[model samples]
Target: MIQVKQLTKRFGQTVAVKNVSFSVEKGQILGFLGPNGAGKTTTMRILTCYIPADEGSASIAGLDVFENSLEVREKIGYLPENAPLYPDMGVIDYLNFIAEMREITGLERKKRLREMIDICGLEKALSKQIGQLSKGYRQRVGLAQTLIHHPDVLILDEPTTGLDPNQIMEIRQLIKEVGKEKTVILCSHILPEVEVTCQRVIIINEGEIVASGTPEELTNKALGGQTIFIKIKGPKGEIDSKLNNLPGLVSFRKSSEEGHNFYRYEIKGDGHREHCEDLFRMAVDNNWILSELRMEGASLEDVFRQLTAKEK
Candidate 1:
């Protein structure tokens, strides 16, 4: 659980974060998104108590982040954009060192280190030096370090930055696995990753909170965006009038393919799921053959662009 109210940060006259607020429920993977310099990293640093906010307040679980930074640290596992690694230390050895730092000791530390190594698929690189690990393995090692503490919350900033396509997918799967029972706030520029992994999203622009909701909720809240395609063998004007009978109906566009015509209807968001059956019945009554009908929902990328475009 996490909460922030009008959280902001500034450097001199430049505001790095401005009045941004959002919450993450337990076991929820929340996508934290924005363009470059939109305060994602800044906000994350504040939440993790790595940096203090200049104004407003943030709390994790039940304690103020600034007031209880140490307690908050106990509950969070943070992976910054550039995760540190001991170049010469062996992978397992480095992880063991971090384990000891986290106050894990004796058999407990050893067991967690083994589990983390297994979870991150680093068994083959157990004895390999950190510098010998490839970039992807290094990222996993960073993740392993974050999980070695067995934290309740994970704050990952650009977790999959330099990996290839397969590597990215691998990391995303790893994130999904780890997010099962842990609260996670993942900051990423890649739209698909968020769409795939996050149940809810918070979009920030120019340090202000622009949008926050489930992907579907935010997309549907965008008014004036109902478009349905109809494929039927009715005379053009007749098919057009039939659809126009609906409430809040707008103009319809007609296109032809072979002998059939497509009547594309643009209407208000009228919660009209039943319109499909009604339209089919009318088509049959008029002796018109029906072929295709479907609703086109807005893509997440489109929503993101529309929500953030005003910053320009």
Candidate 2:
């Protein structure tokens, strides 16, 4: 339950976010995506009350962020881009400190400490000092600190950054599991990770809101049409010419991979999945041997690039 309306943040003359607006529904994982210097972290900071916006308003669970920051803090768990961690504090000790800061009761302090230890997989590192742990374990320690209070919303800025591939996968799985119960806004530069973790996405660029929707919706709208791929065991030059001359076809890409011909034809066929026959007929007319064919929807990456570039 998070809402940001016309949210604008600026550092003097340099604007970090401009007229950015979006909403996150309860128990939903929203992927906040952008390239570097795209203001993703700045937006997250505004939502978490780490910084104030130049204009507009933001709310968490209906509590106004600017006016009721304390209450909002009580309801959110923020893991910043680079979480501040004491190098010498023991893992459990750091969590204990955060628990006290969150004003957890004596019983909750103990109970939540146990849960954080288990949920974040910090037991083995509990007695170890934070600086001595590996990057992955340190990340888990950061997660433990954030979850110490059992907040309702999680604002994670690149939760898997800097971790090895295995560690990144582990943390991604953990985020998905957490999202099943808590509203999550996952901000990351890794596209595949976001696609796997969030069903909805918001793309921002140049301090403005570029696109927002489900992955499928974004792909469909960005393509502004439809796409299909076809493969034929034929003379490459002839196949290329046939596709290039085809009408209603937006574009075509021909390739030969591992001795097999491949072609991706962009078209505005209006949901007519029967175009495979058209490609087949063209192949027959050219006396090209038929090998394999497939039709695919536009990809999320393609949509993201299209929308962001268009806005630029």
Best by lDDT: 1
In order, what lDDT does every prediction score?
0.83, 0.81
Candidate 2 runs further than 4 Å off? 223-227, 232-290, 295-299, 307-312
Please provide, for model 2 over 154-173, each residue's C-alpha lDDT reduced to its tens digit, 9 standing for 90 to 100: 99988888899999988888
lDDT accuracy of residue 97 in candidate 2: 85
Off by over 4 Å in 1: 248-251, 255-282, 310-312
lDDT of 1 by residue, 161-247 (tens): 888999999999999989998999999888888888899999888889888888777666554455566777767777667777855
Full-model lDDT, candidate 2:
0.81
Superposed by TM-score, candidate 2 places the C-alpha of residue 66 at a distance from the truth, in angstroms, of 0.8
